[model samples]
Target chain A: MPLSSRPVSRRTTLAAAPLLALAGCRWGPAEDGDEPAAEPSNAVPDEQQVKAALQAIADADAFVKDVSADHVGLAEPLAALTALHTAHQALIAKEGDTGTTVRMGTPTRATAALKAVRRRELGLQRTLTKLAGEVSSGELARTLAAMAAGVAQQVALLPETAKDADA
Target chain B: MTGTDALQTTLAAEHAAVWIYGVLGGQTSQSSQPALYDAVTTAYVTHRSRRDQLVRWVRDADEVPVAAEVAYELPNAARTPAELKAIGLQVEQRCAAAYADLVGRTTEDERAWGVNALVESAVRQLDFDGDPTDLPGIDA
Candidate 1:
């Protein structure tokens, strides 16, 4: 018998059957078959950015808590600040989940405290302004921009204290 | 609406802001309060720059920018310093709203521009003793 005419071994055929089956599986339909998964209509794409905004809101709240009556002329601004931060917290919480705990800055003298709060508001506004440009969702972009502007307004409202105090 | 339309809207608001600041500055300058006069002057210049920038943006988009209204409705006569400040704050609030809308309607770089404008106007409102709100531009 010619060498080329030899029959295939039984074990080899069995292995080849499984190999061909495995090759066939590569072209199979997706796990969902013909149907595609439905995307969440209002899912937040940037949860981290949203959390950062929440963190800013929490920091503002902490500053308000740290302030005392000794702050003098800042009483009304501080009170208004508190009201706005509360509203911001509510708005951010509506967008995504936020933790209640926040790292509190050490309390400082009146002037220093107002200045520190103003700096914090400015920082938040800057951050959100940048995020507003980058966020993919239109609604999220609008909200972030508006929040930044609101913080800017708060920064302007902060009392002007001429005297410097030690923190 | 397209980004150009939003920019035009923002340009209109800037026009109003600049005009209102001029009126406020005139009122403040006539009064004995130099400090208020200086503040209004600085704010007036800022609004003027903003209006000019918006005009440039509209021109770059190949659109004819809308002109400022002959007269904007004042919040009141604004004879006193307090009244002037109140009217200034109102102008800022309206400008903020317009910028916020632009932020929503524009894309990428233009959206960022809107964001800065919104922040500027909102902060200006604070100068006039306006209380902070959750959303500066958003109506309650």
Candidate 2:
């Protein structure tokens, strides 16, 4: 959707009082001698959240790579996840951090490997969701939240196994 | 934008969503398309709840909440199940964008609410056959 379609902006041109009234206590002009606001100590730095998310994606990618290599038959099913992680890396990764070459060991059996992948994906989803809430930047939080939701869509489409039923 | 402005934008989207989903539910048949009917019904209920919640938030902020239009235009006639599903996807995509903007323009509890709304709408798009995208709300 076009940004112009935002209702409040359009309404502001017609009438500004009610919307301005909503600003209330929060809205104000800075005084001439005022100092800049300090960063909240409790807030997670954006760089930290981004780095953590990138590392999680890298780890998940490594695990998927090992599992697919061990079980060639599983490659097709895992390709979707690989694509998702790669796209996410492009969006959130910094220049030097994009190259994550960590290798993870795979389970002996294909079923066990698939189960492990599912668990890891779910864990990564949770990590992203938590990071979304804790990050200092609102835009980054939105991106992280959307990433979590994308993982959720993939989780929903995974083939249901006996172990998955327990999960 | 301020938090209240973001809330109002989201509220406006919810108004359109609630109206659109109601039309979609009416277009679907319970006997012939039970699954679709159920999805549409669920979407309608969810959008209605979100709309009401947005109204409350805006009112609490001491602003007059935007009123819902008397009617909303459907993307198409939506006579077939396929058409209905398409409209459903459109409604959710729009809402997802709105929530994404809300997330960027708010903070604390309000931003958290926007994050949840964005996630829900992204998942809801899957019900209408949307592929799992890398970024659910970002235009890219």
Model 1 Cα lDDT, one tens digit per residue, B20-46: 898887788645887778778888898
Worst 10 residues of 2 chain A by lDDT: A5-14
DockQ of each: 0.22, 0.18
Query: What TM-score does candidate 1 reach?
Result: 0.71
TM-score of chain A of each: 0.60, 0.68
lDDT of 1 by residue, A70-159 (tens): 455466666766676665556545433445544455335667777777776777778888887876655566677877777776666565
Docking class of 1: incorrect
Choose the strongest candidate by lDDT.
Answer: 2
lDDT of 1 at B131: 72
DockQ for model 1 equals 0.22
